[model samples]
Target: MNILVAATSVAAVAFLLLSSNQNIPESVKPGSSAALFALGTAGFLVVSSVLALLRVKFSRWLMLAAALIFFGILGFQSLALLVSSGASLPAGATPKLWANVIRNTLEIAINAWALLSAKASTFFMGNRPNQSSEADGSAAAQL
Candidate 1:
């Protein structure tokens, strides 16, 4: 989880750098796209950290959702770049494209895991008296 957060942060930074490059298209500029990406990543990090610190059950899921959304945007941009390039992806595009796909897929899966975990937690914790009751209900229901 920590690794995922770090990776997302790194990706956001990379996107900001790429978007800032003068050689890149104006549409891909760092203004809106980079800012949004950074904001989302930051939000994910904050939410995840707070939940984890507070021992909240849904922290992982929140982080996962954020990761998915963040990487989803990047994947969409990559696809757009490929399309705009007239399907003539760069000579070394395969490795990078596949890498991005894998990363995005992983992010999606992690997000899904988080979602499931959060849902399960919420289901058991619903209207419970306290954390102990929630835990007991969850354990009892699991069997």
Candidate 2:
């Protein structure tokens, strides 16, 4: 579904931003703990998105897990943003924080909607023609 794919699209954006070093705080050096954590999280999110879109029966659970993980990350970032607000920080840091917060929030919302939608449930659980007949070997026998 378009809505489900949209969630992956947001994750792709996050992956690009993090991979390009645009989202790393200036104070954090390359290969530092914080930087690595950000990159790792982005990578995990992208992987989860791919798995969710793979049309497997377990895709709903995968999507749910990704959504929950992202929600946790968003909460952590929001707390960090609040605490850092009074401190003197790089000008670019605030905008990047806000951008990530907004983008991830949107992604989480979309994932939630897709998970709850009947269409998505059906898509995830429904067997494709080939898959449905494969178990009985009818399709293979026809060939």
Candidate 3:
């Protein structure tokens, strides 16, 4: 799950940066507020995901929050584009827009499905017994 998040986050940032040189989305145009927000969210996700890979306890929560936020923003942008364009392919919307929306939607679904699972929760929070208490118990038993 962490790997998925990390990979997707990196891909998103790379795509955004590379696309900035060409037919980028209007909402995320350079110098726009949306662009700044998107960049910040992407940065947060990348950092949190790396920390999650390292098994940092606080980073688990951070990654969850960052991923959800990133998904939310992308989902909103995609929906807005579709609705504004009347969901028509020939309605001034480029193929790139459609592709990006589809990709974003898929990422949202997969990440949410993985992140909300019981296994993911356990992985983030851990289920190990307290080794310190066990050690204390053994020492007491010896005494």
Candidate 4:
């Protein structure tokens, strides 16, 4: 799951960065270079995935950090979408906003999924006896 998240993060960031060079996505662009921050976040997420895969003790926190960033982006976009006038937005802003919102939401979900999988187990809870190795574990567990 972490691998999936990491890979998708890379791909998404790449696509956004490349596309933003031509036309900016409303959700990801707080400024001219804000997409660069998204790319940097993706880079961090990839590193955290690698660390979690290797059972690094501190990596779970990194996972949470990335998740928080995704959640913040998604949450803010969702709120903005709820209140903002679609007619006032730029041409194609609606689709770009929706796309970024969905993408960020999915990445947040993947982070949650990875946090419970066997690969990232050591990163969170220590080596305790018999934790369930559920892929998409506990829908209730969110941070």
lDDT of 4 by residue, 1-143 (tens): 54566567668766765574745646773443665676676677678767766556777778678766756665576659846876787788777877777776776777777676786564456542334344435443432
In order, the Cα lDDT scores of the candidates are: 0.63, 0.63, 0.67, 0.65
Of the two candidates 2 and 4, the one with more favorable lDDT, higher being better, is 4
Global lDDT for candidate 3? 0.67
**Per-residue C-alpha lDDT of model 3 across residues 1-143, encoded as one tens digit per residue:** 53455456557655775674556775563455655665678778888877776667677678778877876677677677777876565755656676767776777677677767898777777523333344445674566
Task: Provide the TM-score for each candidate, comma-separated.
Answer: 0.53, 0.57, 0.57, 0.51
Choose 3 or 4, whichever is better by TM-score. 3
Which 10 residues in a row give candidate 4 its minimum summed lDDT? Answer: 127-136
Query: After superposing candidate 3, which stretches have Cα over 4 Å from the reference?
Result: 1-29, 87-102, 126-143
How many collisions between residues are there in candidate 4? Answer: 0
RMSD of 2: 6.1
Order candidates by TM-score, high to low: 2, 3, 1, 4
